[model samples]
Target chain A: MESFNLFASLASAIVLEAAPFLLLGSFVGALFEVLVPDSFIERMIPKTVPGQLGFGLFAGMVLPTCECGVVPVVRKLLARGVPPATAITYLFAAPVINPVVLLSTYFAFQSDLTMVFWRCVLVGIPALVLGGVLGKGTAADILNLPKPVLRQMDDIRNENHGHDHGHECGCAACGETHDESSRIRAVLVHTGIEFLSMSKFLIFGACAAALFKTFTPSSVLDLMQGNNFISVGSMMLFAVLSSVCSEADAFVAAGFSMLPKAAMLSFVAIGPMVDLKLIPMFLSTFKRRVALALIVVPVVTIFYLCVLLAYLEGGV
Target chain B: MIMDRLHTILEGLTTALLGAFMYAFSISDSYWMLLSPKFQPLTATAGFLLFVTGAAMTTRKPPRNVRRWGALCAMLAFLALACWAVLGPESAFAPDPPKKHTPMSLELPEPGEGFEPRLTLNDKEYVRISTPELFALIEGTNKEYPREIAMRGMVARSPDLDKRGMIAVFRVNVFCCLADAVAPGFLVSVDDPDKYPQGSWVRVAGEVVESAESHANGEISLPGMLMSFVSLNHEIRGHDVRIIDPPDMPFTFEVRDKEPFAY
Candidate 1:
């Protein structure tokens, strides 16, 4: 396929696939806005080192919000007096450790319970450690989010007074200001808007993925065979560059069956926990130092573990 | 206030209408048309028309409750149709088949040994199979062939299989469609790994051997499948390769009562 045509096809497919996910995330994140009050979270967050780490890991399992999109909300929690450490933990853990990603992972990896269990353990460790460590600092001022963006915090807070017709479920940020009549308008408009906004990224990712799959020669992947430092390094780069969403990364990883198992495991571990597309959102929602620290620390730790496992296995 | 009230009614109408449409679509047989090029454009146009009409009705003063109800019903009908089309004959509550355990004796190279072949041999051909069924068959077919077992299937690479060779051949069986399909890969130790590229269907017959390795805990266990066994199982099933695609069913109840969402 011509580059242009490939791009177009991929763009459309990605958006369509990702639409439901993004909307679902948005709906659930908005509900978090309503159900869990800022003060409650602020009060509930742990104050000590181990407490912060434990809370961070547990939060990742329970929170269903997408990591990338959840950044803004997590940042909102931070601004609302929630601890920076807890907020940071939520940010990192939310993306990779959620129920949706877990379910998808279980299905994609041929229903391997062992793989699923290790995935959580391997990814969750750094999220807890770095999040708690990073929380100890006073770097919130470095984030530099605009005041107007910050005002969205209050927009959700005051929503209950503005619009009330019925359907007062108060379950979603969008649903909160809507009566029955307005609910249709909200769902339609929101769905349409969301579909348009996110379709581009989805399509871009899918098309590129499919094209890469069809065109990329086997030798390219073969080059990274074995557990040599270079091979592990190259595969890690591949995982990060693929930027496959956490939910879909396993299929792509599985597609590379010719590659070593340990390296493949590393790809599964690192890709979803951190990715290029999701980084900016993380930066937007958390302290820059904190985001940077969270991303770099977990990746480095997991990469080392992947190499160690391969080494111990005599080139798995 | 009037406009807000009107908008509210319209919003509810749209949600309720879309809900019903999604529900119906879940149960409808024409759901596959949603993926069809010819059908998608038509549906998109219809959706646009409804959206515009919806916009107009909401913009009007004191949005008529009747129109709102009509819109809600329409939206619901559309949603119902979408849902019906997407989910076909699959419900979560359906009773599962009884679990059966198979002893490793049937698959063992030696009748008394515990090793079992993951794929089943049918009419001297190896059929693609799941782990459980494969084991079950092994338990049932408790006799070692005097000769090597030969099976024919496609050669596709699978992560679950041992990834020692450059090209791994696998055979996949499609029960319904590619959506809910399973493929089991056989480990073939290729001398010239590059000669047989990925995605090639081949016939391979090999004596399976178990190799032991030490774990981090210092316990030794065999994890790798060695190709002590040998046979060139047919690489291709020439005439029967073509499988017909089933027509898309829109909204069949998913056997599991999970949230049924139309794709």
Candidate 2:
């Protein structure tokens, strides 16, 4: 019973911390669906892969969505014909590169810019590389959407191509609502749909994380601290199991001041990109192969980078 | 069509319930048990938005295609989790010490005009400080250290500290939530370590002295620390110890600008 209670507390904490961001992301996605036209996205994005990747890498600076909320927005962008590379880059990079997360990292590390610098480097490089590699695939190859969802995307594309419904038509998809009341209602409906669609995955992920955190002894991670390779791996594993929000994870990493800088760096860097909560979200959002690539690429890239860092520091 | 409408309605109800659960935590102080106080307003706003979204959803026309059984199960699962959130214990269970030893220290406030060290408790005064704060104060440049000081922490047994006839008293510092909690505390030379059992909350007024002089031997090898425990250098000699009820907010938070307590 006590274990269950602990699990409940931890799970609730994860959910409550994430729920607001999820709602915000859903609203942003809904607003994008209602207000932003597909042509606008196409016209705005650069045609070249490099340009698109650059745009995706830094887009989070403006939108500033965290990992929890970034998925929904990325889904909307992808469905609306945003370049795969750009959307994928934004999906992975936005959580760490955004102002909120960076600021938190700065504060957590007592204004040490070095940690912040490495974090961006580690996450940004992998995100850009993945964007370039993964973005080459077609929507059919990358997206694991349901039939209805696919049909809806087709309908939007057809609608965009068929006729230009100027602002007067009051169509819900075109940002031209008959009145302010209906526009709000439209946004609400879209948000409701998106939230419902994504939140189940969040709940499942939180449950898994909470169970792991409650039952696993902290000593397990401690025992591995002697070896640099094992320490970095252990911390990365801890990051995945903890599934802590990127905004607050810096403080958690800072708590392990005794650990090597590489180990702590791995904890913060890997957490936002991949974790227990993100696995289900990734599987649901992207194709099996794309999702697998997304997970494997980041984990492998980050592990090598952190180990290299340990070697540079003479800990290896 | 009926199944479609039912599915939409159930999703709406579950959404509303989740909103209500969050709103309850926000309005009541129980939110601090799960999240930092910084998130209270955000939680409240999210709850309101979710409730509105859900209420609006129930009034909408049923979709042409029914939601899949998988979606329905997901909604049910979300509902179950939300129910658990509402029904479960508010505070997290006490944290166990991490296996890896990290010598804890706090950033010391600059010694200037506004530095006041004395804390008054129950009409009596003692130089009150946290274990981390004590560590900082001793290690810092200031030569004069307070003779009698009060510190509060949960008492736990440590074999290294026990070998030197001492018990550990440490407060768990939560960075964000319970998942990232770390206990950073002091070893105190007490009359009877058994009298203050593990996890018992205590407020001890003691003199800060060199650990070497406080115990039989100056050298005590901690499990993970090789010559690292020697660097701890200081321990508390308990003059007066009292068992106390755990504070409503048992956990200490990382010191940000001004807000000390999560609530």
Candidate 3:
């Protein structure tokens, strides 16, 4: 009963924190579904590979959102002709750049600014690399949805319910003279649909994280605290599998005060960028091959950087 | 037509209930079980937005997209409610405090001869500190004589209350959310432990002194204190345990610029 209560509370807390971010991200996505045209997004984005990758890398920081919310928004962007590289870059790089994430990281480590600076440097490198490499192909070449499913989605996008929504394409995407009420209604409908579609991953991820933390013995973490290499690896694994929100992950890392600064730093840096929860999110949004690339590249890169830092600091 | 209509009704119901549940759970103060109270306001907003989105979906004809996809929402809803039900309100309330404890320790040089002059100094002045800070101060022991400190927190009787002759007082130290909360404790040795019962809110004002014998998992520091102070020991303790009103927020942030709230 005690273990159950402890796990349940932890899981519930994660859901509670994620709910608003999910809603906000989905709401923006739903709005994008109608208000922004495929052409508009295409035109706005830089066509050159480097330009797209660069834009995606910095987009999330400027936007300032959580990983939970970023998934859906990236999915929407992909659906609307956003380049895969741009979408993937935003996917990986956004977490570290976020203002809330940075601030939380600062306080969680007892106002140590070095961790935050190092985190930004490490996260950006992999994110840019992943964006540049995997983003080579277009959505048609990269995405693995069945022909029928793709057709269905596209048909839904192009549907005109005999009601006038715009002047040219019968959509809000065109320079349509939409009444305030109908526009709001369209926004609501789109937001509702997006919310319904994307929320499952968030919920499942939270539950998985809660159970992982509850069952794993604190002794396991305590044991690994001394060896810098082993401790850093274990902490990073904990950070990813734990799937706690990036904004709140710093606190989670701090709770393990027994671990060295290197272990703690890796947990904070790697978590916001990618994790178990984001894996499901990636699968849902990108092709299976691309999703694998996304997870593998980021994880492998972070592991080395963390190990090197541990060697330098020498944990107490 | 009938099948389509039935599906619409089901989808609308699911969306509405999930949204309503988020709002209901948040408003009930049950959210403290899941996240930090600092995020209390955001919970309310999330609940409202979810409800609004659901209400809109209920109005659409035939619930067009409600398919196998909707089942995921059900799964999500079930997981959330299940967790909430298992973890009751008293999850944070530790009626029976643990016997063993781990306090903050650092490598500081031992105290020199003129460090304090007196082993235990008695004074009227009281310094305010969080439980963790209190642990740090006691660990360092630079002053030599214990300083008069006042701390507010939940009081729990140690399992070896009679054998050990002390009570454990602590506050749940939260960094970002409840998930990362750690309890930093201080064992106050009272003349009569029965006077202040366990699980009660009170203010303990006392000067923590170095223990005579080696305690549990005690280690000596580099320079200052010869013996490592694992447990809390107060020479001149405060008998006047004032019972105070528990504040709206039951957490202690305890960081720089972030004042520790009454917990």
- Return the lDDT, model 3, position B6: 65
Q: What is the DockQ of each candidate?
A: 0.05, 0.29, 0.25
Q: What is the TM-score of chain B in candidate 2?
A: 0.68
Docking class of 2: acceptable
Poorest lDDT segment (10 consecutive residues) of candidate 2 chain B: B222-231
Cα lDDT of model 3 by residue, A1-316, tens digit: 6566666666566555655655665555445445655455456688799999888877755464467567655665666678888987887777667666677667556677887787777788888898787788666655667445665775665453322334112211122122335777767655565555545544555566566556655456446665877888877887777666665566556655556777777887778667776777778757888778777887788888877877874421
TM-score of 2: 0.71
Query: Which of candidates 2 and 3 is the stronger one according to TM-score?
Result: 2
Candidates in order: C-alpha RMSD to true structure: 13.2, 8.0, 9.2
**Better candidate by TM-score, 1 or 3:** 3
Q: What tens digits encode model 2's per-residue C-alpha lDDT throughout A1-316?
A: 6677667766666666666766765676566555665456557788899999998988767556557667756766676678889989988998888776787677566577899999998899889998998889755567898545875865775454332222212121221112224767767876776677666655555666566556654455446566779988988998887666676567566645556888889988999999887889899878888899889999999999998998885432
Q: After TM-score superposition, what is the CA distance of residue A43 in candidate 3 from its true location, in Å? A: 2.7
Q: Of the candidates shown, which would achieve the greatest TM-score relative to the real structure? A: 2
TM-score of chain B of each: 0.29, 0.68, 0.60
- Per-candidate interface C-alpha RMSD? 13.6, 6.3, 7.6
lDDT score for residue B262 of model 1: 12
**How would you encode candidate 1's per-residue C-alpha lDDT over A1-316 as one tens digit per residue?**
2333322322232222333344444444434433444555556677776786667666756555554355555656655656666766676677667776776556445567666776776777776776666677543542446435555644665463343432122221232233335544444443432222332333334445545544554455445664446555765676777665565555445444445666667777877667776666557655677568757887888888777877775433
* Clash pairs for candidate 3: A13-B34, B109-B223, B109-B224, B110-B223, B110-B224, B111-B224
Interface RMSD of 2: 6.3
What lDDT does model 3 reach?
A: 0.59
